[model samples]
Target chain A: MRKKGSYRIKDIAIMSGVSTGTVDRIIHNRGKVSEEARIKVEEVLKKVDYRPNIVASALASKKTYKFVMLIPAFSKGDYWEIVNQGIERAEEELSGYHIEIERVFFDQYDKDSFDKQMEILEGMEFHGIVIATLFKDSVLRFTTRLDKMQIPYVLIDAFIENTHCLAYYGTNSFNSGYIAAKLMYQQIGPDDKLAVFRFIRKGDSCSTQVLKREEGFRTYLDENHFRGTIYPVHIHADDNEGNRNILDSFFLLHGDVKAGIIFNSRVHVLGDYFKARKKKDFKLIGYDILDENVAYLNNGLVTHLIAQRPEVQGVNCVRDLFRHLILKEKVKKMNFMPIDILIKENISYYNNYI
Target chain B: MRKKGSYRIKDIAIMSGVSTGTVDRIIHNRGKVSEEARIKVEEVLKKVDYRPNIVASALASKKTYKFVMLIPAFSKGDYWEIVNQGIERAEEELSGYHIEIERVFFDQYDKDSFDKQMEILEGMEFHGIVIATLFKDSVLRFTTRLDKMQIPYVLIDAFIENTHCLAYYGTNSFNSGYIAAKLMYQQIGPDDKLAVFRFIRKGDSCSTQVLKREEGFRTYLDENHFRGTIYPVHIHADDNEGNRNILDSFFLLHGDVKAGIIFNSRVHVLGDYFKARKKKDFKLIGYDILDENVAYLNNGLVTHLIAQRPEVQGVNCVRDLFRHLILKEKVKKMNFMPIDILIKENISYYNNYI
Candidate 1:
């Protein structure tokens, strides 16, 4: 009955002496069909062994899909804005397909805000959801609810383990850290002391992303048998005085530190501190293409940037959701972004792509 | 008249007391309409500010578009095969949009083969063409013919200047070279002699892409005031005995050369040569993610590979052609690819994206 896979719905219809619409309705179990037509279509279907393509059938159907994107609120920092722009581009490209995107923004610094938004989303109905944030506990609880509701979700930017996500689209944080260490290794000697800066808000634990990066950095140093002492400094990001105090104490304690690697995007804070003191000898490597970081990179104060393209992450989040929900396409579990090594000369091209 | 951006074909059809199909036909200048319907649509077109989106209209129309893709023939070297995979992906995505892609292959090292393919293409009619090759003279003549024929074309993999191409999708060879130099700079000193290796066929001149990369590499060295003498070595790619002889001579003359940069993807040849001799002191930088090169990178023989994603380039070549020909979207002149710096730790993620 399966034959050579050359039989289509039209062929079935022709064989059944029925219209294609009638055959489609019979196959989909939608729309009323005459008994005679239904029986004829069923007979042809059974004889021809037609297996419908779920993706193609879904596309052929006139069904509207709604996708909700949960992300951090826009701020003066252009990172999330660029990400939103990527989502908008996907929305525009998918407009003709009867797909709608609803954006829900939560305060990046507030776990309660995320919980409140998820509560509101629990009351609504959407085919799929895309989430991008670092609120681990809240996301874990919400994903439990999503699991109970059988709603598929995708994670962007930061991935959490032990969760049932449709897909994860982001950078491999540990690998990025390992590569950052390699870049720093090129400039430093075996015995040269290096500083690891982790900037965090007061009372906030370092993000899993940042922690993985630090682990990767340390692992690289260990595996390569580097004799350098790694001085770890935690700066309270919310208080300038506290940050200054931490930096001052770190410098006084580790005056021999020749290079620094920031585990997060706030490398500019250290760059500014170094610049103000006219410290030209210390080399730094950090993450992201935030304006301050790029400025520091151009100033030669920040040597290299490990760019995990946030825009690409956002775009793929929406695209993967579309594929999973509307097209019924199989999505890869992990969509790791390229770890882009950005310098002054190549930033323009990278910017254009993003 | 232009009150707001709210005019649509349905609105015109409503006001003009015509069916939407009639309005569409009148707007697109397709499918004959009654004289009365035509007059009404024309009057509405004159009165209200209605600008038909050329792209949407083209998509809505029943016209089928044909695109020709000219690329190097695939061999055991999977570079062009990956590119063809990208093109095939695009074709599959655009299959429902009435777009047909005709792929024509040319021998990589033969100008006559390219010329023959171009002559055949000139005789046929295609809406657009995407070409990837560095046969400069043949391309210039073919592009002139394309210009006279009013066919828009795109260049991928290698870009030529002062052509009437719709867009160029590939790495900026010079910037890639400069960045490669930067990567090398991190591992070399002021007086350390470096060698530049260009591997080409016996009779073929150095490709424009390779030459530009060499220029960029030299420019970086000059701009930074490097005092090292650059030894340039050209090996006939097809002659193994000749390549070994040349490498032996190069080593004998420049035994102090501690670093080398390959201007093309054939860096694996040199890597193998060096590895067979148990030479581990030379830090090498090369281009592309060809299998042998990645193996060398994993084996720690190749320090870095500058990946100008051929797959991404091929994908964009088709997409940009679609935008220009069918969508009537504004395509940027130069679509420079990001110079992806690949090390062992991050190459897996980059490979996944590719």
Candidate 2:
């Protein structure tokens, strides 16, 4: 049974003594009808309030929206995959619209993989692009193409400088680092060293994002009159055996460095080192809520995980693109995810959700 | 400009060499069409892919959804107001649908005010409801009518027991309190006293949510085999001068109770007390991100604010109501919110746009 004050089209048609089609036509303003039928429909409509459809009208206009997300290729349940899950959620939301979203993969560490994806995308046509902006030089080339093509794009994971992107949706790397430093500094002494882990892939240049985080982390420590040394430790991103050699030697060489912070989502790499050694004591601050990071967090090896809302970024990239391109709405240029400080007590509420 | 590999109904009609009306009829299966025209539309349709619209089809079916959110009349920038903002956001998103949500407010402190609202609601009908089940007897009486009317309703803020409510959309109160205790337990010793603040309103009995929180807080301390005294301190929800007298005496009497935790959103009451006193040091853990609470948090009085995403609760309560009632979608009965631990460093990302 319908609630009071709610009327169906069939009910309105019955009240107006006409077919639902006549009522629908009068309501949508699409077709001609007899003046008598129109008046009858209008009389019923006057008592009712109905809003015209949103994206249905967009579909009616017959414009197809193609949005592509250029991101790193990763295994299931990794950082990028979680971001993809959010994009998939948004894709499900806009499934009815004449809109299509394609995810293009690149090797995060390999410039060649990135360049391959860019070359493949060279012949592609899209209404908008959502690029992860990982590799700066290669992205400069691709985004320049976007600028030349005049296709509005959003930058995710990093905020690239001097770009004409429609928006940037990611963490403020500096603030995130400052916050992570705040957490780490609370537990450490003025003389205790903090190891900043930078997991390296082949031929990978340090991103401006990572460097900004390092700068912010150092700035916080330096401003606090930290007498301890803050040193960088670069480890292989994929090579587990080689990583063991690097980390085992580093920890053995600098036993004073108990407090550590990884600037990337691969903080689990350090966790893996500890996991293999069967020791779960580390004041480590890492990034992302990946299952690996969380498992280490529960095991008490990782103290705090500063999270950027990748899922939110994924969802907003698609939505904001639609708003700007299809709905012609003005969009914000930068949208930073919140710096979430997750401890063992508070991490359950924050499982890949905004 | 349109993206590649997408088509509109007009384009499909053009592809089929038929009028848009014939194409629309075949796409929507609305009207009787010539078999030849249908065949032509089918040929064009086979080359394209489209998922039918979600809510627009509900509109096409012509059902009006009337939802009512019966909540406490709160001041601007308060908890309920933030929830209203989330609800308003959802309302804007659903502006194209045939649904109208009405918010009815009542005096939170007055049982008569609640009864008066119940009386007003008695004459009205709703397709579904989102009620802030505060007063137990009053909600029990009101929900009995809902059961009689066969109208589904969702619970917000506090999950009342033994109610036929469709779902709950708020923090798991017990877990929230347990987490708060963990934070407070970090600073206090077994010999130290912990004050559990219960801000009392007129004609108010302790809510089940608050009691569960109290139970959880004590259980955590007890589970740890603590010898600390955990006691309740009842103060007025309103009477400021009386509250000042009560608190001044309580502090004078028990100087050992430096650590405090307020279970409900009205923790700002204690913050206001501290603000007036210009006291910047209190190991106080409160709930919600009220401006008063956040200001005190910055000033170093309130240490942590456990934020239940009232805004997210507001957004979901409406959307879930629509999903269950209008869209006929299966909805889970218990939708607990993430218990967000808001500190001075992590508070920036939480400006209520979740």
Candidate 3:
């Protein structure tokens, strides 16, 4: 017998009359060993001085991996820049491994734009794909193609439950909205009416976040036994004319609506519209950052901004992809980055995330 | 010629008259080739097209790594439990790469305990070590020995400025304390007297964190134009009787003392002493999560707890160690996790990290 804490797997292997692979398999409890062989191996292992040399083993066997990521480009108010920042952080930290990333960015708004991007991607081979698709039709079509090809992929920022995906990373849009509703409920009394404004681009189908957020907002009110009326309105995201008309119609209809919730990034437009009209104060909650949103956030027009660390989602997705592709590691199927509640006090610290 | 977007690196390599390794090196800019060779390879790569096959590459190279972790054990009432939780999380996520972690825990308060642990560790070979040391002299000695032996190491939750550590993961102690003092200065007036309380175990080394925090707290007071007597006190962490006498004497001597700050985790004892005597409120700031401190926080006796995600530190340290051992990656010499300000409203969220 060796001295205290001085034993190796080679000794165990020699004693057991087994190969090192067989010994390792037994140690890690990998399946497919004969009962007789396993018993013999275990009997010898109990007597011998044996421990795995982890560092040398890792160095000798370290393999390289590669992953491919395809997502919407951060253009025209796309919040992908923050997500890219998150990806970069993960990349810089994980650069030592053989894991590499290939990225393709598609336009956010147009369906044909996705098709054009897909045309460029069909021939490129990859272990996995990470995508944030705004339109259901395009997402389904692309996902189906991947499924048929048997390529593993993760969805970031948004997820489609119907598709076969390896994993997802994003905030639960509905839960965030529900939480926001609860926050408003605490400050506003039973007599107040709440309105939800959704600014969606015309024909933009990746409104899953908006729809889920709206559901969560209403669910909070319903669950809390609140007797407040909730009004939801959808306006063209970038159309000032449509936004103005919807705002006018909603205010004219309610006249007493005290608090408002804007689902998605167009909270800025609502803030701008209100600021232009010079309304002093109306408790408002919104999603994402635009120049308009920050202005409202600072001026106290936007009471809370439900920030989903977009950059973190981006960074984490890439990190997970690296793990899956390079390490042949099992990545978590559903990775939910926290729903950060941002007020003016905490907003400055979080300004650089995305 | 193949259809658009239908070609891969294999086709490019075949046309380029170069090995796939050469092609990969060119793509990554690893730069070992002559200019003429590089130009020729690029010319052929452009002609034939080169898309990466991410999956085949991952599957082909099935590498596993071994990491060795040497950390401080959770002594009775020690907050290192939170740090262990972080390490476990990183391990769970890293299991896919066949990355196995062998952990050895040493007592923080005893030098002989660490020596005994290190003696056992030297016989058992490892690629890297991640440690949180409280006994600075022994630790620095061990670190130097490890460096001489050519083993990589990462330090967390402390600052040993002169050492050549592979990485340091924790708070920017001085800045964190300075920020805390600035926050306190906002509430306390210029005429008010402030007291600084440092709770330390008898015979413990005066750590960089403690010194830096004290320096920062004092600097803030000086810079803010506060004209008041600032008294500093260091008391035995476990000596309740001695601590009480010092506390009572300080209060009696300076009855006009308006605020106090605890540099370490000794606020619990102070909070308890005050509670026993029925003093409910004090503008107090302390560090870490001891049950006594939490009670004071809930009751509003302690104004704030400067939380430095201990769990995150543990997790990141192990992760860094893994990268060094398994992936052959170089880690940063210093990694400062953000200093989080914990208040009553956000204390519940701390459970996630723990």
Candidate 4:
């Protein structure tokens, strides 16, 4: 019949027949307190499940801290823009706690932009940072410096191994890829030909998510012993002539492919290519829900989409990072974002804010 | 570069060139402030977007509230049990704010049990209640009394219309059904035979979600001009002989049925029947993710599931009701939950808490 509640320090003091100072000292493990008084205070605390109110504590200590977000420079209506909106939401929610968040973006297609941003971050004074690990080598080096400075950091979008990350908030790339294959189980048979299409710009950026997703997809097919020929094609992004040459070669060679998967957020590029040719009956699956992808999905150009909840991921990364910085709370290290399977039928019901 | 935040009352008063008491009175719409003072305060409030801090105000009031959850009696591993867990989560989150939740259950299959529970509820002194609107007539009548009593209530699982409820938290049943039919578009063609299955016990409980889902499902097929015949069947629940007879007749008549839909959480029962028969090529879509249903899903009996986020609905229902009651805030009437599409591959990614 009792509620899951905590008693106030005053209540604990009265119950333990001790002064509030002794209880406070015991609770904080600071100053000094007698062993008998500590045991009595500990007993009362245990009995009442004495969890201090986070909101009150946050307001009581008016110490201000700064956190920075290291992400890709994005235009409006892009995936990074959506992530920025979510970060803004978290910033608003934590405004009363005096936690300031500064967003710093680097060009995802250029390693020089990453180095430039990292140089700026090196001189900035911040308590914590959230990174979208686009450039693996640059980010790892920066994280090493962060570890030396004792600054906690969170990784989003993708992660690096052997780095001291406070937590990682993103989709499990391998599982998402495996699930993409699973979605095609009812449609594509064993003898059907499958393709993996990836669009990339020239850069030394980390390809962890891309490689992991495709690996998972192939692993599923291999594990199921799918009796089909699989094809993988890489197209140059944002280079019209280069992409055209690459894609023309792919279509001429693998036009008979029954199904395909795009490992990145630009499934729309494939949709655009197919739209011009009026392609039909070719099942296409990909990642994220850009508006172009939704239009393609509705028109049946794209069969299904696996959304990584970019906004949701951004909100959690900042919120949990703040919890650790301000309240000294322990956060789970690997907080995987949900992999939402979206079709034209169920897309309206998928909530990114959840 | 400014954050989305509000200004303090002191700052507002100083800006308006008035006393803090005058600003407070103007803000509260009380104590007959002068026209000039009111104008100044109003202008400053609008300019500064003076939203009062919910947490600070909540702590200052130090008032307590009692919210009652009137739901179906739940076993340890049932759908209702999952909803209960969500309610407990919300209850614990609000514990620091002095809000207490009391759970009251009623038999879902018996009208008399509902009546008795309603009588007990009517006699209790509660700030608010969250109801699982199972029985339409009885619930509507009770809502009328609640309106007169000026006590707010929220409807979960399903809702009854024409009532002054504070809010309704559940999936939009029609959209869920329409989406269910959409899931079958790739598998079941226009010429495939489909069946709608229902299990019921003798009672006057309202079947809003069931009827709406079926209606939506049919609407999709009808809109598409499906050439297949859809057979609807009802089996008596908890009556072994009656269910056996009904199912036997159904199997004798429609042994070649290619697809089926269950409008409730008992898809596992159908899975159980098909298990022994080793039925293949029959696509069965149903609701919820009970352990039994998940087992069948993993074994390939249940093809896909559309989940209503039952626990998420419960948590929101209670939390929003508390906000409306204690914070003097306005709440939206209809909060439709996301309709998550689940398969064996992506089931682990579904988060009820979010």
Candidate number of the best DockQ:
4
Q: What shift in Å separates residue A183 of candidate 2 from its native position after superposition?
A: 2.5
Interface RMSD of each: 5.0, 4.8, 9.0, 2.5
**Residues B244-353 of candidate 4: C-alpha lDDT, one tens digit per residue:** 67777888898888889998888887887777667776899989978787787777788888887887887888888888988778998888877888887777767752
**Reference-based lDDT, residue B109, model 4:** 71
For candidate 4, what's the RMSD?
A: 4.1
How many clashes does each candidate structure show, in the order listed? 0, 1, 8, 0
lDDT of 4 by residue, A189-222 (tens): 8988888887665675546788788888888988
Best candidate, TM-score-wise? 4
Model 3, position A122: C-alpha lDDT score? 89
Q: How close is candidate 4 to the true structure, as a TM-score?
A: 0.86
Error of 3 at B21 (Å): 16
| Residue-level lDDT tens digits of model 1 in A143-256 | 898899888999887789988999998888888888888888888988889888876652354566888888888888888889978887877655777788888888888888
**Native A-B contacts reproduced, model 3:** 0.00
Lowest-lDDT window of 10 residues in candidate 4 chain A? A1-10
Which window of 10 residues has the lowest lDDT sum in candidate 3 chain B? B345-354
lDDT of 2 by residue, B1-354 (tens): 232234667778888899999888887889889999998789767756544445557866657789999988999768788888889978876765778899999877677788899899889977988888777788888899899899898888777888888888877778888888877876777778878888776665666677778887887888877797876888977788998988888888887787899887777788888778776656899888878788877777888888877888888889888888877788888877777777776677664436
| Model 3 Cα lDDT, one tens digit per residue, B1-354 | 553334555566677777777877887689597777688878976765654544334324556455667776665555677777778888776643445577788755455776788788778777777767666676788888888988888887777766778888877777777867866775677878888886554345565577788888788778878788888876775688998898888888887887888877667777887788787656888888766677788788887787666777777787777666655567666666656566553454343312
Worst 10 residues of 1 chain B by lDDT: B1-10
Between candidates 1 and 3, the one scoring higher on TM-score is: 1
